[model samples]
Every structure is written in C-alpha cells, then in structure tokens.
Target: MAVTIEILIIILLIILNGLFSMAEFALVSARRIRLQQMLDRGEKGADIALSLSEDPNTFLSTIQIGITLVGILAGAFGGAAIAKELEGTFTVIPEIAPYAGIISLFVVVLIITYFTLVFGEIIPKRIGLVYPEQIAVKAAGSIVIISRIFGPINKMASLTTDAVLWLFNSHAPQDPVVTEEDITSLLEEGTQAGVFNEAEQELVQSAFKFGDREVTTLMAPRPDVVFLDLEDSFEENKEKILTSGHTRYPVCRGGLDSVIGVVSVRDLWSQMTAGEKPDLTLLIQEALVIPEHITALRLLELFRTATTPLAVIMDEYGSVAGIITLHDLLEAIVGDLSTVDEPDEEPGIIEREDGSWFIDGMLPAEELRLLLELEILPGENEGVYRTAAGFVMSELGKIPIPGDHFVLNGIRFEVADMDKRRIDKIIVSKIRHRGDENPDEKTDNHTTS
Candidate 1:
C-alpha cells in the first residue's frame, strides 16, 4: 500500500513536470503579434499570454523552479520507494542478494529517467510546439500565479543570471533582425520540396526585392522619354502626341532640363474634339520631382502624398535624369504590366539558333543578370549606372562603338550595333571551358526597353 502511494506520487510529479515543460516551450514559441491579434479579436486568455510573454524571464524562471523541484522530489521518493519494494524480490536470488540494493536502485533510477524524458519532456515539447498559441494562452494564467507565489526565488535567480553574465562580459545584444532573407530562404526550400510552385516563388522573391530597388534602376532613361516642347503649337505636336501612345507627356520649356509640367492626353483630346485651341501651359498639371537616388518604396510614398501619376527624376546637379510613372513602380512590385499596343519593330532581346543571345544595351543590368544567370557583372557599379550599356562603358572606360568586343568572366560581349553615341545591340556568347562538352544553355528571350 505504501509502495502504491509512492508510485502514485511519482506519477503525479511526472505529470507536473510535463505541464511545466509544456508551458515553457509554448510561451517561448508563441508569437506576440499573433497574441495581440487574438486579443483584438476578443479571444480569451490572449491578454494574459501577452503579458506573460512580455516578462518571459520571470515566468520562465517559475517554470524552471517547478520542473527542478518536481524532478528532485520524484528522484528522491521514487528511487527509495521502488528500491525498497524490489529488495524483497531480489532476496529470492541468494547469489545476487549482496548487490540487490544497488541493483534495485539502478533499475528504479533508469525507469524514472526514461519516463521523465519521454512522457515529461520530449512528447510535451512537441505538443507545445504544434499548438503553441493555444497551450501558451491556457498556461499563462497558471504560470503568472505560480511566478507571483515564488517571486522572491525567481527574482534571486534572475539577478544571479544577470550577475554571472555581467561577470563573463556576455551581455546579450539585441541585433536588428532581417526576416525577409529568412522568408526568402524558406520559400526557396519550399520550391525544392514542391510546396511552392515556380510562379509563387518568383512573386514572393520579387516582393522581397521590391523594397531594395532604386528609382534609377526602374526608370525609363532620358532618351526613351517622349515629351513635348512648350514652344511647339498644339497643331504642330498633335501628330507626335497621337503617335506616342502615352497618356501623359512632360511639357518642357526648351529641353529636358527646363521641363515645366505634364500634359495629359485626355485634356488635349477633349480640347481638340471641342474645336478649341489648347493652351499648353493652362492644360499642364505640376509634375512631381523625385531624386534619382530615392528607393522605389520611397518613390511610391511620394507619389501617394503628391497624388501624381508621373514624377520627373532629378540628378544631383538638378538636371533631368529620367521619368518614372506609378505604373512603373507597380511593375517593380508585381512584375511587368502588359501594354495593349503592338509595335511593328522587333524587341531588344533576340535568341539565335546557335544558342547565343542578342541583347539590347538599354536593358537594366539587373534584368540582364536575371536573363544571363551571371552571379556578378564585371563592371556593374550599382546606383552609379542602371543599364547594360552603362556597365560596358564603365568597364571599357569609353563609349563602345559597333564591333567593339571584350571578354569578362568567360563570357564574350560584342557590340553588334551602335545607335550613334549609345550602345544599341550586343551579342552575348558563352566561352566554353575545356571539359564542359555540352552545357545545357538556356536564354530568356524577354526584353526591356
């Protein structure tokens, strides 16, 4: 009967140990943001859970104390009680009688340790991890009460830990956590595991890179920007405006540097249809001016605050650098926006039968990098230049004329055509290494203007 009572007490201690283990794991793993969301939704015990999580050290100290005490008591009472009961059974074997007490004690210790480790620790921890929020909320109130009861001991333990850490010069520093990289890594792993499809992975990766992009990297270059001279009459520029296929055009005073404002095609069309001479200055709305070095994320904010669809990018010297529209910024986040009009000319990138690529110089270096799968470009100076032409110019230290060629990192870059001053077309081919007999080469045929 005494042995039965002892066993029951050990079983109770094991259960208590499991509870403390569960509470500790659950509290540590529970997301505070998720708890606050639950609290906002009027979920029960979420507030308590959040409060406990905020001062985790105190509540965790309480759990540690409970677990330690239960373990000690279980080992002390259980080992002695079980060994005493087993001594009678060992006495029947006369040869082993001399070592029976020690043998019984060892057996009892092993049984207690195994049950405590499996049922009390491992299983409970797994359960806590699986249902952290639920277990944490349920355990929060009890742990808070227990912590208050053992406040003095918990305080002493915390102080001791702090003192020891200070003595060892091991103060924990709160570093800025970057969760985007972690999420990106997880998404890549998920793709490999077939949990995420190719399109889903690309969208997620694009979202992560969106905040890091600069306006210069995404903006249409100055040469590509179609604008109207304020000095030109409505009749003179009507053909250009109609053929441009753009909704808005920057109305410049003399050149791109002397720009005044933007003219919407809708306003011009209305005036033209009404048989009224459109006053260019009166029809123009003020253009939003953003620095070229500004990030795409910041550019979006400025666009929202200014309530303008298009912004003129300015260099450090106050000259017109490029132009960016709201559509361009959205494309940076969600990928390219398709246009309705089909152009008569061919696109900038063309793939040949020999597996070589014909690329346009105006394509952004980032876009080219994605196309070619190059780890790093030879002369790619980020923020200094945006396009593949700029990268080649930086490397060659001059404008590359047609037929100018160079080799970098086992890839051959040949200027196929030059548009007067700027590089127009480049032929890119891989210089195969000695032993690579048949490399599986694939090229992205897509082009960026």
Candidate 2:
C-alpha cells in the first residue's frame, strides 16, 4: 500500500478505537437513575442507552471486539506496510541508511502507540466519564447497532465466561445498584458544591432513611405517654391535659392498654372559648391502631387516610406500645418542630454545662449516634432495639434499674431514673482517660455527677 493510504488507514483505526473507548467508559459510568430520568422525559435514544447499559455483556463485548480489531490492524498493517515507506525516507541520510529499517520500525511503532494512547484511549475515556449520561444517550443508537452485529459472538463470550466461573462454582457478579451510601455521598457532595445547604442536605439524607426506620425508633414510648382516664372526673382529666400541654390525649378506661379513643384539646378549648360546657366524652374519637413494627414512612401514608393524625402503636402482644402522630413523622423528616404542646424546657437531648448530656430514654438510637459522634449503635441493623433505653436493656440483658450504668464507645450511660420497669432518664457522659486526648471528652464519665 502507498504510504499516504497506509497512514490514513492507521488514523481510521485510531478513530475507531477512540469510538469504542468512549462507548465503553460512557456506558460504564452512566448512572441508571439519570438515564431513567432522561427516558422519563421521552428523550430519543435514552431507552436504548438504558437497555445497553443494563446489559453489560452485549455492549461490553461489542466495544471490546471493536477495540481489539482496531489494535490488531493498526499494529500489524502499519508495521509491515508503512515501516518500509519510513525506511526510504530515513535512507536519505546515508549515515543512517544501513540502520533505516530498524529505525523506521521503531519510529512507526512509537508514533502509532503514542497517538493510540492519547487520542484513542485517554482523551476519549475522559470525555466519556465526564459527561457519561449525555454521551451514552448520544451514542446509544450506534452502540445498539454494533451490539446487534456482534450478538452471536457476544453470546459465545458470555457462555465462555460463565463456564470458567462454573469451574470455580461461581457466577459473574450482578451490576451495582444505587445504595444509601451512594445517595448520601451525592447529597454531601451537593452540599460541598453549594447546590444544597447543610440543613437541606441533612433533611434529604433523613428523608432517604425514612422508609427503613420503624415506628418504634421515632415514637414516644409508653413511659413518656400522657393519657386521660375515663374513670377520673372531667376536672381531674382537665388538670392532666393542662399540665402535660399535649395536643391530644389517649382516653383510656383502665390504662394505656385499654385505650378507648383519643380526645383533642382543641375540641375542649373550642367549646370553652365559645362559652359552652366542655364535654370530654363528646370530643372523644377512636385512635387509629397500627402495628409497632410498621415503618414510619408507611405510617405517614396511613395518616393520610385517617380522620385524625393520632395513632396507637400496638406491640405483637396486642398491647399499646406507644403513641405517634403525623407531627412526629413530619418532625422525623424535617427535624424537631416545636409546638404549643412541647415544652421548651423538656427537649429530648440536653447538653449539660459540664459537657455531659441528659438524653431522654425515648430518644432514638440514630439521633443518639449523631449527638454522641459515634459510628454506629449496637443492634441497629437487626431491629433488636431502637431507643437508648432499648440499647441499655439489650446490653445489660435485663430491665435496667436506677444507678445501673455501662460504657460504650467511650461514652458512659447511667440509668439516672426509671419509671416502673421502663427507662425514663439517662445521664450520658464521656469516659475520660488521663492522656493526650481532648480533656473534655476524656477520664471518669467527666461530669462530676
């Protein structure tokens, strides 16, 4: 072949190699969520891109085949055909004439390799990775056509791969899925990029975890529940309602276990404001009963269908476990919402002046982890326990009594108070060590309690 034709063919091969490199990297880097979004908008070739990305064997085999062929042809043909032409040019210098063939072959290989690496691999793959979804959509049609052409060969390659894996009693791993960590990292990255504020990023992260969290973690456990008794006179129940300052009261005849209905303070106050007698019985409405094990997200949906936001969470034993509200679910998503019912003095977590903490027994483990700066809490994955009290019970393997304490992750949890068998108040302090560690967080549960 002529030197000009040989050079042109090598250039064409490099361009083909670049195309294959771009397609392979773009498909690999393209996120399924972004591709699905593009498809939802009815963008042309998006569906094909999504399909090609989802089937790695087809598109991958096709790209590998194209790249392999391009490399072979470029190396083999450029050396035999173009190296002779280069030798003729090198022979012009008589001093190097005898060594022209050797010099020409080395020069040809070096130039081709350099161009192939830069234009064919690095640059194209960088472009692909930087704008993966967009490039995937744009190249989707061409890639699909190539995949179709190589379908039989692709199938054979897949079978060979599977057979090798079968020898090891293993199969190829499935493609990656979007995980909580992936979304969390994205949210944090957005925060760093100024796309979302820190609070907004936290809200999104919490919302993502909403479905995975059970009601038990977020509920006001039975110990903290303030109820009205039907056996008590209206004046007695009124005192309880005014003292607790809660919006709704579970109206129980016997106890929390025998909750008959819920009564709203608004109803009683509305009648009183209208200069009419407040009748507690007339204001009572049946509370929605839900299993304690149900997710907070599912309960959020359930609230949408109910007449009132209040619900009684029943344990597997059919006894009332706790009470929850739509407000509770919203607070879980958006952080604490202070209401007329919630007294400012009684926050769930309180940092003492001594740097120790006064955390309520009902506080969720997730929130505790954030407050304590701990990596994880025990039994979080298994749903074995949800609250700080539950954590204490699990660690101790019994109902903890007042003054009982334990240390974990350098934090000492002391059972400061107990309401019957249930934990009511916890004194959380750092276990300080006399060392180079930060003075505040180190040595005997540092609070001189």
Candidate 3:
C-alpha cells in the first residue's frame, strides 16, 4: 500500500512537470520577442525552449500525452505493489485481504488526482503567466524528447480534431491579412497611445472618412467659374480667359448649359502656332467627366491613371455642375497653405469684422454647429459638403443666387463671393438684438449688394 502511494506521487509529479512545460510554451509563443530578449539576458535556455513553444498545437499535444503515459505507468506498477502489501497485512481471511487491496487502490487514486490537479495544472499555468520566459527556458531541453515520444498519438488526436472541425463546416487555416477596419482600428490605437498628434490622427481618420466622399463636396460649383460660351468669338474668349487668371477653362457648346469640354491655356498656346484665327472648336479637349455622386477618392484615381488634372462633375441628368482637381483632393488630405509665413485668419468663430470667412466649407457639421454656437443647422447632412457655402446651397435647393440672404439660428449670411458657380465667400453676422442695434450693421448698409 505504501509503495503504491509513492508511485502515485511520482506519476503526479511527472504530470505536473508536463503541465508546467505546456504553460511555458504558450507564454513564449504569445510573446516571442519578449521571450527571446529575456533568454538573451541568460535567464535560461531560450532557443531550445521556444522551438516547441512556437508551435502551440504540437506542444499541447505532447504535454498531455507525456503526462498521461507517465501517470498510467506509475499507477499500474504502484497499484500492483500496493495490492500485494495489502494482502500480506490482512493475511488469513481472503475477504479481508481483497477488501483491503481495493481500499488501498482507491486511496492511491485519490492522492494522485489531488496532487496532479493542483501541482500539475493550476500552479504551473499561473507561474508561466507571471514568468513565462524563465519557465520556457527551464523546460527547453525536455520539450523535444517529450515531443518525439508522443508524436504518433499527437497525430491521431490532430486527425480526430480536424475531422470534428470539418463536420461543423469550420474553415481551414489560412486567413487573409488585414482588413480596412483592422487598419483603422490600429490607427485609432496608435492615436490613443500618443504615437500620433491630433493633426496626424485627424489626417489618418480623414483618409478613411473622405474615401467615400462624393465629387460634389470637393468640386468648384458652376457659379464660381469663369468660362467661355461656345458662341463667344475667339477674341472675347481670349479676354475672358486672361482676366480669369486660370490655367484651364471649361468651354460649353452654346452657353453654361451645354458644357462640351475643358480647354487649357497650354492647348490654346499649342493652337496659336497653327496661325488660324484660333478656332474655339479646336481649343476644346474631351472632358473627363463623372457623376457628382462618385467618391472623391475614386475620382482622384481616375484622374491619376488618365493623366488629366481636371474632371467635370455632372449631376444626375448629365449636366455639368462643378469641377474637381488633383490639388483639391490633396488639400482634402493635408490642408492647404501657399507659404508657411501666412497667419491663421480666424480661430474659433467666423467673425463679421472682415467681409469674408477664411473658413473651410468642408468643416464638419458638428464643428460648424459648435463654432457658431447654434442648433439651427441640423446635423443630418454630415460630410455631404466641404464648406458652409456648399451646405447652405444644398439646403437652399441648389440654385443659390447672388445678394440672397438667409437666417439660420438668427445668423444672417449674405453671399459675398461665389467661386466658379458655387458659393465661395459668405459674410455671416448675428441679427440685431431687440434693445441694441449693431453700429457696423447700420453704417454698412444691411441691404446686401
């Protein structure tokens, strides 16, 4: 009986050793570099340890098989020895000896269970978690021998597990690398960890945010552009082009209503060498056109591959409404400033001290709402337009006119400038309070020109 108990304890210890080794493997695998670094510092034998640890499935199978075999060996030999001792001690009565043998076997089994469960499973797993690298190094030398002994059993177990997985329609190993959302999440984490400043973080976030942004948001609306009507004479067209100070102009067949193509000054210069009267028909090149709803990102790509700088944005009915350029897309990502010496014009709110707001129309609806300190502009149309003028124009049913004024949350906006065909510069001012009249408002002619 005593001999049986001793054997059971040895089996339990062997099982415990395997469990500890398994835990070490898991920890090293989970954090390979950390483990390797620790090993380099001479905590223990890291290279040999990590070899088994790196392959979790193999390590786990080997550990379980090794422990079980050891436990079975100890139990079988020890049980027989215990049974013999019990029979000798009880002597004489056959029934007494048999009963004593059974009791001894039960006790030995109970002891083995307690020792193996506590020391083998719980203790080592905990220690591995705390000092994984150290434990992994310690167990390095034994991992290979243990693996070899259990290789056949491990294969059988693996086959069974694979069969079960197949029955449930589980996927086989290889999964594709990185998703868009995953990349975004990683950026977000980097932001939180202070790896990115606010502007840099915003730039990354904007890349994802504006990838789906439509062409209309970045386009120069029709109202703000200077163009030559198809019927206009060559001299008249030349005058308009020179005065507009633009490198390119959109030429319509009849008027603004019949946009035919975009014509560049370079094209015009090339045509001048032909010595004809500079025919307007020959000046136009085919317009690279897209629906207004097409995303700016996609539009930018089309522009890149086509090698065209300008793309005409069209409405649902295929009428030219606006244009977007490569510069516009780039500015959307990094912002625009011609020189570093330029000062930031307005900080918090768009004040009425000056005639125009040097503000980005593409500023978020929430931000615009907060800056103006008004709730009149509902946050429903976020990311729809890039600027306040565009938002107002969209709200006003698209054909916003010059000298038109509207009140949003009691703030009055008068059209100050239109870039191309769209609202570009707007003068926003608060309405007069009941008791106090604004001095500037009264002097400046509240009547918008």
Give the TM-scores of the predictions, in the order they appear: 0.78, 0.82, 0.48
How many clashing pairs per prediction, in order? 0, 3, 15
By summed lDDT, the worst window of 10 consecutive residues in model 3 runs over 439-448
Score candidate 1 by TM-score against the native.
0.78
What is the C-alpha lDDT profile of model 3 across 330-379, one tens digit per residue?
Answer: 87788664533223333423554643344444344444665667654643
Find the candidate with the highest lDDT and give its number: 2
Point out where model 1 deviates above 4 Å: 87-99, 175-208, 230-239, 276-282, 302-308, 341-382, 401-418, 423-449
Candidate 2 — number of clashing residue pairs? Answer: 3
Q: Estimate the overall C-alpha local distance difference test score of candidate 3.
A: 0.65
Candidate 2 residue-wise lDDT, 26-120, digit = tens: 99999999999999999998999999877887788788888888878876786667888778998999999999999999998999999999999
- Candidate 2 TM-score to native: 0.82
